[model samples]
Target: MIKFAFLIALVAVAVPSPAAAQGASGFSVVNQTGLNMTNLTIRRFGTQGWKALGNAPSPGGRGSVQFSDPDCAFDIQATLEGVGTVVWNGVNLCEVKTVILNRNASGAIWVDYE
Candidate 1:
């Protein structure tokens, strides 16, 4: 009986907590647009409030956001230097590790999920 109890305790110690099992809960943004990015923010999908992600990457650079919430779906918004603000809606961070921001020949902003 003592051996069984000891084995159970060892297993419990080896098992990771719920938060640790979840791993990292955020994605990195790759700035491919020629313009600098600023005022980056993220929020849960269908939510009204936005949480600032801070320190957006410059053109041809990358930035990462680490969120505490366990939700996998989120909306991202950023303002491009000398350009208007842009938003990428309903992005699933769980599936997408990298998001690339780009601009078309017509100067319209777009996003690519990777």
Candidate 2:
């Protein structure tokens, strides 16, 4: 019985959970750039028009935007109120659960991965 229990525990440890195995639902848009995002849009890479997400900063100054994405892959376009447009192309929504929006050292808007 002890050996069986040990085997079960080992199997459980070896297997990844549903959430871990599959992709997470609705990837999060993390804002670390300290700028309020006035607009957010997403669509397939290489597409023309974009679908608007909304006009709201993450939550706090350093919070993130959590939105639903059904596809495993997608793209993002974020517009800062006073800043310029920052675009990320061909983002794998499933694999990359969160897309970080921040400014680079040169003071230009850039995208970061986790």
Candidate 3:
């Protein structure tokens, strides 16, 4: 009985969950700026409404957002505390695993994808 139970547990651990199988459709965000990201939203390119991804990954933290659209292009919006709102247009989530928020030397916000 003990060996049977251990086999079942090992099998369960080896099998991927549904969400993990679908991870190709989703992406992660890495916040590298000094300010806290208060709000994060995403929308399909050329769409009118924004879908909230989630709340603050405080400075230097990271978060993940799952999207359901079959389209690969999207626009991302972020609200940084004390810094107002910033948007990155026409990002291809299908090609990237992580979107990194960064600040340039000129004090402008920029993005990097990995």
What TM value does model 1 have?
Answer: 0.69
Range of the 10 consecutive residues with the lowest summed lDDT in candidate 3: 17-26
Ranking by lDDT: 1, 3, 2
lDDT tens digits, residues 3-94, model 1? 99999999999997875556336678888878878898988889989989879999899988676666766778888877778887877676
Model 3 compared with the native: what TM-score? 0.70
- Candidate 3 ranges beyond 4 A from true positions: 1-24
List, in order, the clash count of every candidate structure: 0, 0, 0
TM-score of each: 0.69, 0.57, 0.70
Tens digit of per-residue lDDT, candidate 3, span 1-114 = 999999999999999776555423667888888877877888888998998988757888988776666666788888877778888788777657888888654668777889
Candidate closer to the true structure by lDDT (higher is better), 1 or 3? 1
Error of 3 at 46 (Å): 2.2
* By TM-score: ranked, best first: 3, 1, 2
